[model samples]
Target chain A: MPTQPTDQGPLTSQFAGDADMLELLDMFVSELGARSEQMRDLLASRRMDDLRTVAHQLKGAAGGYGYPMLSQAAGVLESQLAAPVRDLGEVAHAVAELQSICDRAIRGHRPAA
Target chain B: MSQGTSTHVRIDAANLESTRPLVLAIDDSPDVVRLLQVRLKSEAVEFASASSGLEGIELARRLRPAVILLDIEMPGTDGFEILRMLKESPDTVQTPVIMLSGLSSAHDKVTAFDLGAADYVTKPFDIAELRVRVRAAIRTFTLFQMLAQRAQIDGLTGLWNRSHFDRRLVEEVSRHARHASPLALAMLDVDRFKHVNDSFGHPAGDAVLAGVGSLLRKIVRDSDVPCRYGGEEFALLMPDTTPEDAAAVCERVRQMLEQVTWPRHPEHNVTISIGIAGAAKATQLAPEAWVERADRNLYAAKSGGRNRVVWTSIESPLQLNRAG
Candidate 1:
């Protein structure tokens, strides 16, 4: 656990306390690095649609996985991508911020049980 | 209500389906389905998943899962369209559907409910909350199942009642007519049932009837429908069974009953006479006429000898075989 709750913590799943969910949470954490890489690839290729799809999925999935901040970050990115007026700078900033959280989650993670 | 209701959900599990209810989750994301399977594992339910709308709907029809978890957005036909099709099909209409969506707007919720969804849960779900909702939906679905089925059952023997037999006879006849498939109808009567009642009292007579019901229930094929035709008489409608096959089954019932020794009157043996009428293609006569044919055969069985089976198939004249 870290001092800050949402943005600066050990990124432990809220479900870590649930004995039945430990394995599912562990599998999700193990897959985090690949998900991050997929995001990077989609962004690098300028496949905004595919990247937005990924963001939408994460927006739904992250909170369920007990990372509410990651869910919120991906949700913001998804909303920004949906906007008709393109804000390239804001979109890039959101992507970068989401990537950093993913980094923190991958680095600080310890599997429950 | 006259005890024609079947409280069979908790029956000895031999004569009815008692397996855990199935929960089907339809979502494009494998992770969401995987998460659901892990979260909802329990004694009361089993879990299955489909990745697309079409697969989900097809599975829904085939498995008749107790509950369906539908995702609103996907690559192919969306959840709303799938829900519409499910509602349209009678096979899946009664199953409880819970919509899973990323969109939580009141408009979306209202639309799902309008389309006959029992509940809606927005993603990122509180897993615990989803579990509770799923259980509630299963409760509703199974209750509906029991209420719909119990109406057709006979309370005394746990077999279908007379009215149900009549209705299903017509339905089966029409269905067989359409398909040009074989169907068999058998009329059975307890031989000297009145003698048992006169000597052993009404309770023993009732016990004999109950024992015959269990024997019929145990011996018949799954596709067969055995019913109490009223007092000392029973009927069985066998879909897709030929006259020869039907006679074989009837002979077994006759022989079995002839061998049963009443517990109170150990020396007394109960017997039944059965007459079966069948056709590969449905006979052109009304179902009542068909019943009369079987009744005539039952008369032959009783006159020829008690504890015997008589049968006739369409494309052949009235036939009689004396068998134990």
Candidate 2:
């Protein structure tokens, strides 16, 4: 098993047995994974407009799936991308953080006892 | 993994029933559409989706859905534009619309409401709240449908009222003129109906009228519009029928009425006199004039005998004028 991120702990006890919540978490992980890769490519190409759009979408989608911290990370990237003079390095850091969140989200809430 | 997770767009032809109320979701994102499909599936409604604003408007015009869930930030024609277009078209003017958007700004909500949206729901909505809103919209739509239907029908007889009949006559006349199709009109009145009310009570009179209304409803062809024109008077507009054919139909109805054993007054039977007019091809006469001709023939039927049909063809305008 992959080492889990310190910030994203194991699956919450409340969500462990609920099938619908688990499905939603799974969907969020998958969707975030796609957006993270897209953001990385857009940053490499210095496509600030496209990167901002992806960030804006992720900001809304993450919050909807109960990942408020991930949503805020995406929102920060979105705000920076909309700046008149964008910092590629900062945007890259945000994208990497987003990818980490998605990785942790997919790893489930907790390691099996 | 992401490719595998893409939503399956299931346009299930079998799920679409003509009688079922439709709920349309118009969003560019397939995820949102899929979410709506999943959420709305359990409701007593059918769900349809469009990925673009133009397609959404076209579907709205065609399907006339009970409620529209429109996304505000679509690519080309945004939600406000689509809402304006929906209000402009007569076909969809009355359809209720609910705006959906990720933008939760008060300005956006106010603008949506100002543009005549029935409700506004932000993205990441509470599924339960949306279900309640959708159910409420359906109720409103159903109530409007029932009220409109009730307005067009007579309460006592359960037949189309005089106002609806007149409107239908105008519409039929315009359609027949455009297509040059044959059309026929018939008018009937109960013989000495006042005597029935005088001898029996008004409730008995109403029963007789209702009985005749039921008979008219049962006897007319699907293409025929049977209406209770006024007190004890009924009219039928038969499309694609000639004067001779309308006369036969009227004759059949007259016979049916004659055979009925009056529930209130079985000893004395009720009878009707009928008059028919037909445009074998097309006519330049106004709708009122056509009805006047039928009315004139009805007078003839009453004068000749209270239990027969009188008819005039549009080809014999001179004879019609003389008879009138």
Candidate 3:
């Protein structure tokens, strides 16, 4: 089982050594990365519908896994893409912000001894 | 796994219909149900009325409505119980349910929202706002379904595709190995496909490919899967088929191509060289190994002469006989 990042303070503190939680978190990070790439591609192709779809999925999965920050970013991104008039620049910034937040969360939540 | 747990879930956003969106209205008042039904009639939304929270839960389990509008102030089996049950049941877990209640206090709304109610609509809910929330829930569900479908299908051919084939191949290979069943694979290549493009045109080449696709579909059994492995090449996976049987099938397909006249060149005919490989003996070989064997044989046929059928097992024997 691969190790993964988790929520800080209390929610993830108890499960810091839990290998299963770590594995799940690792999978979550990987999924986030994949979704980020997908968002980039969709934006590049100017596929707003596909971008919204991918962002919505990322939002749901991130929320489900207790990554509220990641989920919120994805949600903002989804709403931007879902809107009738899409701001491509805003979408791009949101995607980059999401990637950064995911990166930080992944680094911050490493198993604390 | 739990009973009825779907290994894969498919959601189609394109098929999302705002019309007749199923809403389970859980409230003691018949007037509330009537009001919602009348207000949403033009939206083509359907309503399943539940007088009590228990009835609401039962109806939800049976009907699997797109959204549930529950009033929190019900007498027995209050909205909270139904909400808890809905969250517990995997079937209803993902379905968005909005809590409708006279308790308009901010705390009550916060609690309901925390309990997984998609949205909290107070007793004096605006009809337009409720409709908007319902549409959003349905839209979210549809998006999830479409994502699931996209995960399974090959974006290119719109056929079963390589990922699906990879998963199926593992199971099929396992079963064949266990039962000692013959599983044959044939690798097919269009004869001088590159030359065809060089001589005629790319559009002509595409036509030839389309023709080959149709021909393969016509020649193979419905159970057999023919995949466009890549450009100018196709692969046929015939489960429970012997190498010799597969060879015959390939030969028949090749003959069919020979008869079909190319439109670009009236005098020219298209042909395909096929290589067949199968596991006649019981072995725990990977599916890719079998495919590789067939691919090697395909190259052999291509080099030996195009427009021929070559079986991997026969190669060594033919060479031995020739040596003798």
Strongest candidate by DockQ = 1
- Candidate 3: RMSD to truth: 23.3
**Model 2 chain B: lowest-lDDT 10 consecutive positions:** B1-10
Return the interface RMSD of model 2.
3.8
- DockQ of each model vs. true complex: 0.33, 0.25, 0.01
Overall lDDT per candidate, in order of appearance: 0.84, 0.79, 0.69
B121-206 per-residue lDDT for model 1 (tens digits): 99989887998999999999889889889988988899999999999999898888888889999999998999999999999999
Candidate 3 per-residue C-alpha lDDT over B1-324 given as tens digits, one digit per residue, 9 for 90 to 100: 011111221122233444456877776644355455555655656666776777777777877788888878655567877898899897789888888765568898887878888888764455678788888887886677678667755444444456666766777778888998878788889999988899999988988888887787778898787777778888888888876778788888888888898889768788888888765545677888878888887887888777888875422333100000
The CA lDDT at B289 in model 1 is 80
Pairs with steric clashes in candidate 2:
A10-A109, A10-A110, A11-A109, A11-A110
Cα lDDT tens digits, model 2, B1-324, are: 122122333343355766778898887766566667766767878888887777888888777789999989766678899998888888887889999877788999998988889999886566789899999988898899889899999998888999999999999988888898999999999999999999988998999999999998998889999999998999999999988788888888888888888778998788899988898998877899889989998998888867888889987753332111
Docking class of 2: acceptable
Clashing pairs in model 3, backbone N/Cα/C closer than 3 A: B11-B145, B11-B146, B20-B44
By lDDT, the candidates rank as 1, 2, 3
Candidate 2 residue B2 Cα shift, in angstroms, is 15
lDDT of 3: 0.69
